[model samples]
Structure formats: C-alpha cells, structure tokens
Target: MQADNVTRTFEDPMLLQRIPSAFLISAAVLVGMEVIGFLLLCEKHVYEITGFSVSESTWGEANEVPSKINDECAENAVMSNKEMTPLEALQTADFYLLWASVCCILVPQTMLSSLSKFFGLEYIRDDSFLAGITMASSVCNAVGRVIWGLLGDYLSFKVPLCCLLLVWTILLVTFPHLSGFEGSHLKALYSLWVCLMFFCLSGVFVFTPLASNALYGSRNMTINFGLVYSAFIIGGILAAVLTRIPQLHGQTFTQFTIGGMFCCVAFVLCLWLKDPKYPNKLKNLDVFFWFREYISLRCFHWSLGRYFRQCS
Candidate 1:
C-alpha cells in the first residue's frame, strides 16, 4: 500500500509546485542588504561641516600657493561656480574635444594591456614572472589613481592630464626596445615599464570624471560623465583595428610607434582645451592665438622656476 501511494504521488501531474523559490530568496537578501546600507550610511554635506561650499573656496587657500592667485583668481572663480545643463555641455566644443582626447588616450592602454603577456614572452619566457609583473602593474594602477587625483586637485586638471599623456607617449614609443636588455635586466626593465604605463593610464579614469564635474557641475555629473566616457567605445574600436593592420602584425616597434603617435595627438588636444572659466580665450579656432597663449604660459612657468631658484 505504501509503495502504491509513493508511485501515485510520483505519477501525479500537479505534485510539484512551480514556486519561484530562488528568486524569492535572492530578492529577500538584496532587500535586507539594501535596508542595512540605507540605515548605516549617512550623507554629509561639505557646506554643513565647513560652513562654506567648495565653490566658495579659493585654489590659493586650498593649496597654500597665493603668489599667483591674483592671475588665476578670476579664472578659478568662474570655473568653481560654473554650472551647466547636460544638454548645454553636450553642445559645447569643449565636450567634443575632451571626448576625442579620451578616445586617443585609451588606445595605448587597451592595446598594451591586451598584448602584455604576448609582448612580455618575447623578452621574459617565465610565466610566473609575467604574472608577478601583472600583479605589480595592478598595485601601481590603484596607487596612481589616488596620487594623480591629488595632483589634479593641487595643480589643476589640465597640467596633470597633459603631463600624464606625454609620459605615456614616451613610454609607448620606447617600450619595444626593452628587449635589448639581457637576462634579469630585461625582466626588470619590462616590469618597470609596464607598471609605469599602468600608473600613468590610471589617471585617465580619475581625471575624466573630475574634469566632467569641473566643467558641467555636480548636479548632472552622472549624465555628463557618461557622455564623456562613451569615448572608450571608439578607443576600443581603434585598438582592435590597429592590431589587425597587416603592416603592424608582429612588428612591435611599428605597433608601439603608432600608439605613441595617437597619444601625442591626445596631448596636443589637451593643450588646445580652453579653461572652462576662460572659454572666450580662443574663439573661431585661432591657431596662432592658441600658440601664442601656450608659449606665454611656458615662459611664465620658466620665470616661476627661475624665481624659485633665486629664492632657494
């Protein structure tokens, strides 16, 4: 009788319930964690704590470099308080310039990272050493984000962005020659180059959002940053296309040289970028005007260096 009953239950069409048991458990866990987070995490306003908004703070005061504040104050003041709608930001030339710069900057990072192992095997044959190089590169990548972010805050975003691109350009162009070093020297140099490349590349992730925020206001930063970040799509496509080029295939020097050229283009774009505060500085795409301004800025930096040398 028991066996017959068991057989009848097994044969029953509706014996098993179509319950969403897994979905219910997952939903419950997600809700519980979210509730806990909501209760634990509290938002704090900088204005409430410091009795002043960040926009009201002067760069001179923040960085304690007041000597040149007079020259920069007007520009800084406008940039600090400037707010733009996402649509307005999208319509601006600065937006497209930044997008193009990011597109070019991403090329080396995408290509090098994808080809790291393959490239490293040409010099260092050991798989374990290559793995260590990757691990070291990752550590530098994390540390660099913080360092670059702080540097941007101190010196402004443009200077650091340009410097980072310049360094990456040099690294990419010269990286293929590391194979000349024999034995341990090759491995060490290769690792150093890879780590430094990663460190410099990390700034892109930090600076892009900060630049977007500085340009478009914090209120709609999400959308503005998202628009800027779309450059990665183009960058990835370019990297893929470059890798598939017949002349570039198995030609490390040519490949790196091409990547370096792209990086140099990004650096120039950064130079041409007008300060958000001084949008009227160069109107009608004035190349001569831009060149004059750049030269003057370089001279000013040189003068400052001389002054500091004399003081010391």
Candidate 2:
C-alpha cells in the first residue's frame, strides 16, 4: 500500500497542486528574506559611508593635477591598462603553460580530497572524530582562500602561488611517512595534515584568477578565466584515473608520491611563468618559441626536398 502510494506520488501530475499551500509558504518565506536583504544590503557610495561632500569646485580642483605627475604615477604603478582580446590571449604561450600548471597543481588537491576520508579512517579509527576533522578542513579551506588572496594582493599572485605549491608538494610527499604515530598523536597529525592540505589548496583558487587578471588583463577576463578553469576538468579526470590504478589501491605512499610529482611539475611551471608587466631577458628564451622554430625548420626541410625531387 505504501509502495502504491509512492508510485502514485511519482506519477501524479497534480502532486504540486495537492501541496500548493506548502509551496506557497516556502515562496512567501523566500520573498520575505529577499525583501529584508534588499532593505539592509543595498549598495552605497563611498561618500555616503564617509560623510564626504564633493562640490563642483572640489571636483575641478582634483582634475588640476599636473600631467607630468600623472605620467610618473602611471609609470610607477604595477597595474597596467594594457589588455588583450580573448583570441590574442589564447594565442600566447603563457596561457597554455598557466593552464597546464593549474591542471598539475589541482590534481594533488583533488585526489587527496576525494580519498581523505578513507586515509583518515586508516589512521583515526573513530568515524565521528574523522568527520570532525573533515569539518575542520572545510573551515581551513574557507579561511585559507581569504588569507592567500590577501597575500597575493601584497606580494603579487605568482610569488605566493609558488610558495604555496612548494609547501603543498612537501606536505603531500611527506604525509604518508608521517602517519606512523599511535593513538592521539595519530589523530592530531592526521587532522593537521588534512587541514593544511585544504589550506594550501585554497591558494590555487585565489591565485589563478588573480594571475589571469594580471597577465591576461581584465578585457576578456571572464572568457580567459573560463579557459583556465577548464584545466580542473582535466585534473579531475586525471585524479579519478589515478585513484582507479590497482597498484595505488590501499597504497598510501605510492598514491601521494604520484600526486606530489604533479605538484612538483606545477612548481617548475610557476618558476618558468613570467610577469607580463615586468618581463625579463629570459622571456625570449621560451620553450614555445623553440618548438615553433623547430617545426618551421622541419617544414622548410620537407619543402626543399620536395622541390629537389620535382627538378630531378
């Protein structure tokens, strides 16, 4: 009888009509919350918050700064007005390199996160304690994003990103070896490792967008960022494939070592990555140009051989 009633509920087109009062109540609650939010959270101008008044004369006076000073400030500022179109950015070597680095760095975090619960259970026998550890890692994830974003703001994105990835690599590589402690020591170390992994993982999210904005410019930021973010799909697929490896099953050391290797590659890529605003002499020595030239030479040789054969 219960199964028949469940089937009727699934098949009934008028099920919503029967629950119209519940639906209406939920909708009303949502509308009320939205109304309250709108009232409390409306946007305000800086002047409104600071109680500053700007007269026409004050505005005119502000614009009277010397052109020479403006030029000097523009030269000194780290922010660049120069921007590229999405197509133009796509053509650059930095774009693909950044994408690859993002993919490599993301794999370690994604794989560890998916297997963390299982790994934790191996060290900490209590399911409830492991759940709490997971919750703490979640909190660390949120906090780390804000902290790392601020660090990026102060140091520029690349430096902080490199540092984070370096530390994350070390942590991943050493995590398995460090799990040999007993009792409370085991739980504490396990929780700390999980939380720190999550914390370091947050920097990838913060720095990627910041780096994209800095390198690619804000002109087509959304599209360019979407292209970069597509690396996560690749990373996720790679992580899933790694997890399914029969040898890696229950083998913590081998699994994390592989993950660490990916992060190490990401670190090397980060080292190679250049700041567009302050490009160095090494910019001309990129692998991309070398590969392009190599291909061009191969094409030239093939064409020359074809011409000689035609003459013969």
Candidate 3:
C-alpha cells in the first residue's frame, strides 16, 4: 500500500497538484525570510549585525588647513590617533577586513553551515532567524540545479531523494555536540552545527531544485521552472506580512523558536511531496542503448577507423 502510494504519487505529467501544494509551505517560509529581512532593515532600522563598517573618526586630517596651522592641535587631534583614516587607510583597512571576512567564509564554512543547517531545521522559526539561517544555508549549499539535472539523467529520483531527506533529518536531530576548542564552548557548538548543517542542507537545498526540474519537463521547462521559481520572490513579500504578527528582528527567542517549529513542520510537509506517480521513470530508460551511445561518443570515428585499418 505504501509503495503503491509512493509510486502513484510520482506520475502526473503536468499540473503538479499535490506535491506543489505541499511545497508551498516551504516556499512561503523561505521567501518570507527575505521579505521580512528587507522590511526590518527599511522600517525598524535594525541592522542584521553585519558589523562590517568604518567609523567617521577614521577619516584622515585635512592637511590643506595650512602648514602654519597649530602644530600642537594637529598632533593632538590627528597624530596622536594613528589608528586609521578614511582616505589614507581605507584601502589597506578594507583589504584586511575583506580578507578576514573571506577567511570566516571558508574556514568555518562547513562547520558554520552545519550550524545553520541544524539551526535552520531547529532554531530558525521567524523572519530574523530564517534570514540569518538562509544566508548561511545559501552559502554552503551545493547547487541543486546541476545535481538534479545529472540525477534526472541517472539515478532513481524517488528513492534517492527520499533516502537523502531521511538521512538529513536523522543526522540533524541526532548530531552530538563537538569538543570545545581549547576549552571554548563555542568550539563545541560550532562543530555540532556544521555536521548536521552539511547533512540537512545537502538533503533539502540540493533536492528541492531536482524536484523542481523533475516536475517540469525540458520542453516547457522554461515556463514550469519560472512559475515555481516565482515562489521565492513572492514568498519574500508574503513572508514579510506573515512574520509581522510577532515581528522579526525585534522578535524574541520565543517567537523565533516558534518559527523554527514551523520550519520543522514545513520539512514534514515535504514527506507528502511526490513526483507524479512514476518515481521509476529512470528505470524504463534505454540503459543498453545509452551505454552503447555513451561508448561510441568517446572515440566513435577514430576507433571505427582504427578497427577498419586493422581488418584491412
């Protein structure tokens, strides 16, 4: 019965009904984050904590004031504070800061990804949390479109996708804490976050795209993909409104916690997703035919000529 439903659910060639409906929940959640983030920045005046900016105090002195200017005043105001300047030190200061930011991006990327992945699944409940979490998820996630395209041509879509999501959820929920860094608790927390993040983001971030492509065929692929993709943009708009109930950036941990819970529910909703009643489409492909074609492409003309020469 279960197998039959799973198989039946994957068949429809068009009008992706059931699965599309369920996926909307996730779309709503993701898009909502963007909308809310934008609104928070615009209206509430609350920053996302980037902490990446320069101070006015770092501006260089206007040396054109004249050589006759008070030497004592110049020394007191500018010379004494050799920290940095907007013009003189901006480039160097920016370079190092950019370097450090890039370092943070790669160094703990996987670990931070795991943390975001885990946190996304566990903690990112509302706009703010989702915003931060998605920001992180977007960076570490494997590009789904490519993976799905290849998989569509190769693997059994249903089983592979389902197996992946299941594995991801299990890894996320069961991930254990890491050893603290030199007795630092953050080190432990960071480790736990990365592992689960890697697993979960890989599962969802990558699979959603494959699922998208799978539902829409290559012929009308453009339009189908477009409609689905719109979810992201509209979701941003709707999310802004929906999340305003409790507010996002100004929202507390409790509200954010609830948002995370909603995300979990959304993940659960993915289970209801099905590929159009034919999850086994790849099984019917002409494997032998493709294999013959595959080999021929490698050295079709040259190999044929070589064989002909040998025979002659």
List, residue by residue over 1-312, the lDDT tens digit for candidate 3: 011222322245454566677699889998999999987784446658776765565433444456777644444334223332222322432223222222222222233333343333333223354445455545444554455445644442444554544554444344332322333354345444553455344544344444444443344444544444444454445444544555443333433343343344444444334343222344344343345456668778889889999999
- Could you tell me which residue pairs clash in candidate 2? none
- How far is 138's C-alpha from truth in model 2 (Å)? 0.9
Q: lDDT values of the candidates?
A: 0.80, 0.79, 0.43
Q: What is the lDDT of residue 136 in candidate 3?
A: 52
lDDT of 2 by residue, 180-250 (tens): 78888888888888899999998899999988888878888998899999999998898888889898887
Compute each candidate's TM-score over C-alphas.
0.68, 0.69, 0.34
Better of 2 and 3 by TM-score: 2
Counting clashing residue pairs in each candidate, in order, gives 0, 0, 20
RMSD, model 2, all Cα superposed?
10.0
Q: Which structure among the candidates has the greatest lDDT?
A: 1
Lowest summed lDDT window (length 10), candidate 3: 1-10
Runs in model 2 deviating more than 4 A are: 1-79, 277-312
Top candidate when judged by TM-score against the true structure: 2
lDDT of 1 by residue, 188-252 (tens): 88988999999998998998888888778888899999999999999989899999989777788
Candidate structures ordered by TM-score, highest first: 2, 1, 3
Any residue pairs clashing in model 1, and if so which? none
lDDT of 2: 0.79
Candidate 3 lDDT score at position 181: 31
